[model samples]
Target: MINTWPKNGRALYTRETVITAIRKTITAVGCVAALTAGAVACGTEQQLSPGKQLSNAFDAMGKQHSLSVEMGLDATPDQLIAMSKGSDEPMPPAMAKAMSKLKVTFSAQSKKALADTEQGDVTGSSMKISGGEGDLVEGRFIGDTVYYRVDLKAFAKMTGSPAPTKEDLDAKLPKGLGFADKILDGEWVKVDTKAMKKAAEKQSKANGGSGVTGGKDGKDGKDGKTPSGKPTLSEQSQKKILEELKGVVNHEVTIKDGGKHDGADHVVATAPFRTVLKSVFDKLRPFADEMSPGGAAKMPKEEDFKEIPDAKVSVDFALKKGKLSAASMDLAPLAEKAKIKGEVPLRMTFDDSADNVTAPANATAIDPEEMIAGAMSLASGARGATGHGGVHGADTSLYTG
Candidate 1:
């Protein structure tokens, strides 16, 4: 039998490592969060130029004190299947069918979150992921606490499992699933962000911040100061990003009057989607490499992006009363290779709005140690349950003799 946890129920990893791992997971999740209604980057038009407009609009959007963004995928299952046909190994029919019918949408409401460096700077923030079935997950950050919940019913249905009702948890949690009590009930669970940091600090100081995961010079990340003849990794990375983005922002992206959309001045930004994507990946690689300790971050070479079609993608922005309002993206061009017979639009809409993010009254306080233990237990057995699709006909059975 495999030992899931250290002896006497103690965690093998330090508090800092666990917290860092959690923080990283959350950040990854945030990146995939849906756009307002629809999302994508755009190209050039007119004397002012659409590229400049896109850049300016993006800058303005970032500077907003409060905002709401929502994004939804507007493609049917048949279109999704057609798009997958060109793949070396097309997605499983069952998976594609389920996903196409599944409406995946993301929305975030926030206040004072332009520069997310300090949590305190963000007075309130709420993010949620909902699907055709229902809400799968939700997260809120208010004050010094983080509140989140997982709708097990929605999650199970999305994952191809029989949806479980709250009654299951009301009586008793399933064996080995006690750590997910709040999640099963679709109730809020709160984490004291400051306490988490303090615990990590206490653990670090006890061992002089020289744990197994710490760097050779007794630090977690690079020193704050810039290296000789160079800017800091973050600063260099930001510059690299801006430089690469210029391809779409200053040249490739164009703007055309979309006329009136919902009684607002509509502008559409267009660009060659593939080229923009390639530029973004190319630019982000250096930064990823720099920030990732031991070169953990990796990016595909130019050849790997060959499959992506060179098609123009356009995003529509709606301005109401001379203020930045909402946006939507047209993604049909990108999937031309699939010969899809219908529209594939990803829509976006954002507005200056109040962020009503607040801490939940009956939120369950999660025990980090127990949460980690449960996570490890599930993780160890997950590989066998999953099918590594690259290998054809590979067994995906959860158990094998």
Candidate 2:
């Protein structure tokens, strides 16, 4: 996350691992959230109402803050080393040859993040799988461009051929799921647990079955309602979930009744999303196919690697004096193929004391022309410093003879 405060003479560039995980989960299902409004089951149990607490928290998050985050996915050692080496285009031949002798374990980590308020950055890292060995693919964000370094020898060994040049990697990298913006706009909050369960049960009964059976689609057929007469999972269901979840969190806020915090209304807040998230997880276990039901992982035919299972997220918030003060996230277990596993972490904090914390600033709406211009300027500066004359932009290229 980058925060530039001219008045405070402060600039911070930080990557919150936990937040990255949460954002990724959010991104993974954000589209579904948009379709599923008012899908939560917020009971009227007051203190026991996890949904209510979550809603309160979401309400408190009314002021959008600029955020920039980087997530590093671990790839199989061999794959990492191979990918680090460059490639101008798909290297099927090299990949085939490398796969013939490939015996290295592989793992991959992919991150999807929101940035500068509106923009988004999605990055991944992995190790190569060849001869049971790998080289690392290292990268960092320099302005808008992400500069990466891959080992050529590692690539060749993994692919059973000489690795592609730095130019190759640069060309291919951008073509693969580059940073995205506005993919997760509109409203975001936890899925309502009660509503989800209730809906799922209704669908199960409506399906004319004693219990809910797992299938790619929510219901066995396209009649919308299940055979037992319960509503099946649909855009309508999801919308209801978000609405209830939002309300759940909002209820925990400890507003001073009239005071203010961070220039906005000073209502107290709590992150019931943590508890609510777990509930969602339980309810969602049976509906994965329906949530992001389509889209296969894209890859060059020759370099076809096994699919990496999706990651899970757990959110926890810290409340101080009845107000939501901080939030922390925990990631689900990683698949065996993924190098990085276990609880990755993320955090978000609100400092009411911050003098600069005023009315939320303008959303960093994207301007394509301006973005292009900005990229050009940074590229120009990088190229000039490299003394490469007219190499288009920066000489951050990793190459071999």
Candidate 3:
């Protein structure tokens, strides 16, 4: 107590009290120092140029081996009606009625590894399209396969069909009517991965080795050999893309405080839709001419391009802990300007703690071959019905002039 008080003090504090006061003072100083350091760091980050920040963000994203992505469309009833009205063709009454009652938002999320870009298992995935009363459809993907469950009662109401059951879905169709026979029983429809792969391969072969895994001109090698794998852009090509993006976009940096994106610094890049689209169209003009009968004459002029309303496309990247943590793209401005009153938002988040995907048990397998055959049969029947000579062709005898 004697050491705690100065010589001038009338009353000396106890030794324990002095110790407590010293500890409290030290804690307060430490907290203030921490706050000052944090503020300094934040200011330093804010001072970074947007381009440099983008490069750092891209580098971080490239290093990530696993990520989760969420994408969705949000639309109100009025928006839906507006979109339908904007369409070239008149909306059917039934469809219009459905749209009027529809207050739905569709969303999907997937967690997957990016170690192998060509093929990676989706460890976990889910999609839900909810409206009026509840979810109209719900689906999940595990490993290489995806399964979806439809609300039969809701679907029946929309399609003006009687209440549907598993038996109704599995029922045998008329001999020539092969369209709906592939529909599976029960609530879930499981898509087979192996079958899908085989189908894709078959299609690739049929298309002269030019499919999803083919090269620029659609062929694999110079001599139209089977594709070894999908062609990846060269480093130079990637650099060129980055350069083009930087040229077109205007970038700005800002700090986000609190909420889901708390304490992270963000870099936002925005570009006018018309300008970007015009550049793309110009690059593709030569190819467009080759594909069209009138060549460049058939191409739309700059005035025509102007018909597309001016809008901005914004992309926001969030950086945290000196690394890129998440990014999002917003197309709302563009959509709104085009008189399309709906929004399609895409967001992706990176995580280093993700585990490998495991195949699900009790999943029902489906046959891709059977589905393809059924689709072809239906297509043939449609051609015939339309007077193109298939199944129910228009009677030429009745057209006697």
The C-alpha TM-scores of every prediction are 0.67, 0.28, 0.52
Q: Which stretches of candidate 3 lie over 4 Å from their true place?
A: 1-66, 73-75, 89-149, 156-186, 199-229, 250-268, 280-307, 313-361, 382-401
Model 1 ranges off by over 4 Å:
1-63, 88-118, 158-160, 163-177, 193-231, 234-244, 247-251, 284-296, 384-401
Candidate 1's TM-score: 0.67
Q: Taking the tens digit of each residue's C-alpha lDDT, what string does model 3 give over 326-351?
A: 65554345444346544634444555
- CA-RMSD of model 2: 20.3
Per-residue lDDT tens digits for candidate 2, residues 1-401, read 11111234332211122233335544433322221222222334443344344445444433333222222332233442343234332224334234324332222222322222322322322222223344323333322333333343554344333333434333323332222121112111122334444555555557574434333444443543222223346987577656555564344222112244444332222223334344444444444444543211211222222232333333344444444554444322322233443443333454433222111223333334333333444345434534562234433322211
lDDT of 1 by residue, 304-374 (tens): 67876667766676776655566655455655767888676665566666556677788888765445444
Q: Which candidate's lDDT is highest?
A: 1
Global local distance difference test of model 1: 0.52
- The collision pairs in model 3 are 384-390
Where model 2 places Cα greater than 4 Å from the true spot, the runs are: 1-48, 60-312, 332-336, 339-342, 357-401
Query: lDDT for every model?
Result: 0.52, 0.34, 0.45
